[model samples]
Target: MSTIKAVRGTRDLLPPETELWNRVEGVARKVFERYGFGEIRTPLFETTELFVRGVGEETDVVSKEMYTWEDRARAASEKAQSLTLRPENTAGVVRAYIEHKMDAAGGLRKLFYIGPQFRRERPQRGRYRQFWQIGAEVLGPVSSGAESAVRDAEVLEMLASLLDELGVKGWRLEVNSVGSSTDRPRYVAALRAALEPVKDQMCEDNRRRAETNPLRVLDSKAPEDQEIINGLPKIADYLDEASKEHFAQVLKALDACGVAYHVNPRLVRGLDYYTRTTFEFTVPDGSGLGTQNALLGGGRYDGLSEMLGGPKAPGIGFAIGEDRLILILQEQAAEQAESKMDAYIAPVGVEQNAAALALARELRRDGLRVEVGDGSFRLKKSFEAADKVAKAVVILGEDEVASGNLKVKRFATGEQRDVSRTELGAYLHGDQ
Candidate 1:
């Protein structure tokens, strides 16, 4: 028989690593809840039209990276539908918002989600075809202040708080404004003209982007194209007065909250929906993410609701590259020791195995993490295994069971003690 393995670009998340993932999610939930955001889980797959309409059809995510298929009709009267695994989540979130008619109640909807997103791109380092994201979106009708610059700053400040709370150091915040829908066409026209002559001098990808989506050309990281990209028309120069004021207000609010940021004129971001403000947080090189160090990025999409066939709802959101975030944390904690269980129960003999199991159950019931060893193992082997997996080892023998006391040894301190059965839970719990 041949062995089957996980598909390329998809890998298993085993123990210890999953522990770190849990910690990150727990912290994210706490921080998001503190900001009045509730959890929202949308389906992993949606009608392909949802994305084609929400995320522009010309965007790389919708064009080249999507995992799409045509779902067959189950009945003669049923029609086939085009389905796609979500490459990004904001579109789905907005789809859900529109589907549920959430705006009918007339209030801002602050929702967060943590889950897997699929993108069929060349995987490398922290980039994967199947990756995890921790993201949030805030949207509502115009009357609810959802379009206010305060909302943008509040979201930015909340992200700053999350990174700091997670103990991530040396993160940089880059901000920019891509202007509103009315201003976008003008800028795209300007960008098109600017790229006409020099497009041939750029990389193949940039050349394609120049014709399809010139704004995406600014997102190119090809070193050979940097010189030409720098000379391209800045989006800031084309921004209308309304967009300029909106960006200024966002920056002012960030400053009032003591959140540091750098304004990058060319940071248009790679999303067609982004309008007014766009931002990204990045870590320094050598942070285990190599050259792909963007921790998260998002921007205001004032017309996303209407674009998705819903009422006029303005919104802002960001998606954290959780896999990259974990990589950075692991690099930072490289020297830290692995955590161990509270106690391991080692049976002195095969005859004491039953008794050891009973004791383990009791300890576990009282909230202690207990691991049990088989009585067949030799005492030395038991000690070695216990030392590796647990902070303390409890010796289970005929005499100890009969006397109602357990022989315990602390691996770290090498101290031995006799703990009564009634007090074993407290001792294992570090109450002693």
Candidate 2:
């Protein structure tokens, strides 16, 4: 027999820490609701084809990281479908959009979700094989204002507000435009031509990226290839008039709303579906695995619906790495101290156990947090246990039960007093 443990690349979140996670989620829900976003929950697994088509097939996520399997056919008449635990949520959300005919509603669908996602990559700090994400998407037909730059600005502004509401400070926003479908080919051609001469000097990954997807080579962070990658043709130069104007309007709206950002020419999303605006939020507080500080990333996908075999429903969305954001929040405040119970009831003897229970029930019913101790516990043992979990201890003895009065010991002030049972609830709950 073998002892069982949590799988590698996964760990359990225990008490006091899970409490912080709850607070973070509560704040996210409140903030998202203020933006008129409703919650949407897609399945944990979808047909493997969804991600292959939705997230670019050339991307590392599709080619390397997904957890996929061939579903068992129950009968000879059935087919064994390929299923995968979703590596990301955007594709599933879009699939739901098409299957449900959400576009026929003729209104924008603003949906948010918080759930677990799976990938097979090796886990390190803030990275996990099975991790959680908090994300949102706004999708609709062009007439519902999905193509407007204002929609892009609105989503960015909402993210800024969410981080602020979560007490995150010193975060930076990086923005860029990856060019539309019509403008991308010209840029790739120019990029391929420029890489031909210098391709031999680059790293293995960069060389492979150059031969396959040239835009992904720009995403490399290898220190040795920084200079060569920097000299590559900029995506900014390839944006047509429409893309340039659209990006300009997004920046203008951000400026009007007082959100600060830096435009990086090398920022690009290689998927053929990604178009116009793209952005990432990062914190430089030295809290994460260096340079892997991106808390969230998103962009406009104007043609994703079509790529996935749906109607033209343009959309923009962002997914926050919940584990990473929680890591940063932990560094900011360590453990957030939660309030303790107001009182603990210690029956002095086994005979008074019922009395202690009655008293605890009364206090609890009055909206007070009360803990009850075993009647068998000695006076010293009860006091020690009560002090750790509550601000005060109520000693319920036979004499107190008969006289309808009890001894109250206040831990903070080290004060002891006798109080009538009639006013016991008010006394324990009363501010000191």
Candidate 3:
């Protein structure tokens, strides 16, 4: 029989690495709570039509990258419904918000989620088919002050705090406004006219983007198109008076909060639902992410709920690419020091295995991380194994069991001591 392996673009998270992952998640949970965001977990997959409507048909996620399938039909009258492994979580969150009639409560709903998401994109370093995202959404009815520019600024400020708390250095915040939904169409139309002539001179992929979705032209990284793309109409120029003031207020709030940022006119992020204030957190230099330096990106979506057949609940959200964030952390810091179990119990004889277990159980019940070794192994062999995995090794032998005193060896200082059974608790906890 052949040994099977993980599917392409997917890999298992194991061991010491999962320690860092857990720490990262723990920090997120604590940090998000400070901002009054409660946890929300949606299904990993949803109906294909949900994404088609929420993520947008023009977006590459729906057009090229989704993992979709048809459900098995049970009856002749039943039609096979299409389902998809979520390429992103926002769509499903909003769907849940609508299904649960959250808007009827007439209050703000702040939800955060951390989980694996699926996409069939070409994988590379820090980019996988199955990746994790730490994301949150803040949405509510207009009467509840959800549409105010303060909400946008608060979200941005919260992200700045999150990155700082995580000890991410050299990070940069780039903010932009693609205008409101109404202002975007006018900008898109302007881009079409400008691209009609110069697009033929651009690359093949960009040429397609120019015709299908011109906002993506600004997002193109092709070197040759940079000159032409720069000369294209800026969204800032097309912004209506309301949108201009909304963006100004967002920036003003950031200024008051002492969160420094830059305005990048070309930063029209890769999503269709973004409007008003759009921003991305990036590490400009010294990041292991290379060309894909965006740690997270999001913006105000005043119309996304309505787009997905929900009520007019305006909101904003951001998703940190967990894989990329961890990569950056790993590169920025030295490898995490090896974690040591509290104690390893090494039995001196095969007959004393039960005794070692009893000792280990007592230590564990007292909340120590205890590892029990086989009694058959020689003391020297047991010592070597214990040294690798533990801070101390308990020498549980025949003499110690009868005398009610246990021998404990501290690996760090190469110190050994004898302690009565009652004193073992104090010794383990450093009270001795």
Model number with the top TM-score? 1
lDDT of 2 by residue, 1-432 (tens): 999999998889986578679888999999999999999999999999999888878777888899999999999999999999999999999999999999998999999999999988878889999999999999999999999999999999999998988888788999999888888888989999999999889999889888888988887888998998888889898889999999999999999999999998887866555788999898984876477778888899999999999999999998999999989888766434233578999998898888898888988899988899998999999999999878889999889999998999989889999989989888987843
Sliding window of 10 residues with minimal summed lDDT for model 3: 333-342
Q: For each candidate, C-alpha RMSD in Å?
A: 2.9, 3.9, 3.6
Range of the 10 consecutive residues with the lowest summed lDDT in candidate 2: 332-341
lDDT of 3 by residue, 83-149 (tens): 9999999989999999999999899999999999999999988999999999999999999999999
User: How high is the lDDT of residue 206 in model 2?
Assistant: 85
**Candidate 3 segments whose C-alpha is farther than 4 A from its true place:** 338-432
lDDT of each: 0.91, 0.89, 0.90
Q: Which has the greatest lDDT?
A: 1
Q: Give the poorly placed runs of model 2, Cα more than 4 Å off.
A: 270-272, 338-432
**What TM-score, over all chains together, does every model reach?**
0.88, 0.84, 0.84
lDDT for 420 (candidate 2)? 94
- Arranged by TM-score with the best first, the candidates are 1, 3, 2
Provide the clashing-pair count of each candidate structure: 0, 0, 0
lDDT of 1 by residue, 1-432 (tens): 989999999999997578778888999999999999999999999999999988999989999999999999999999999999989899999989999998998999999999999999998888889999999999999999999999999999999999998878889999999999989889999999999999999999999999999999988889999999999899888889999999999999999999999998888987778899999999998788877778899999999888888999999999999998988878877313334778999999999999998988988899887899999999999999998888899999989989998899998899999999999898877788
Candidates by lDDT, descending order: 1, 3, 2
Clashing pairs in 3: none
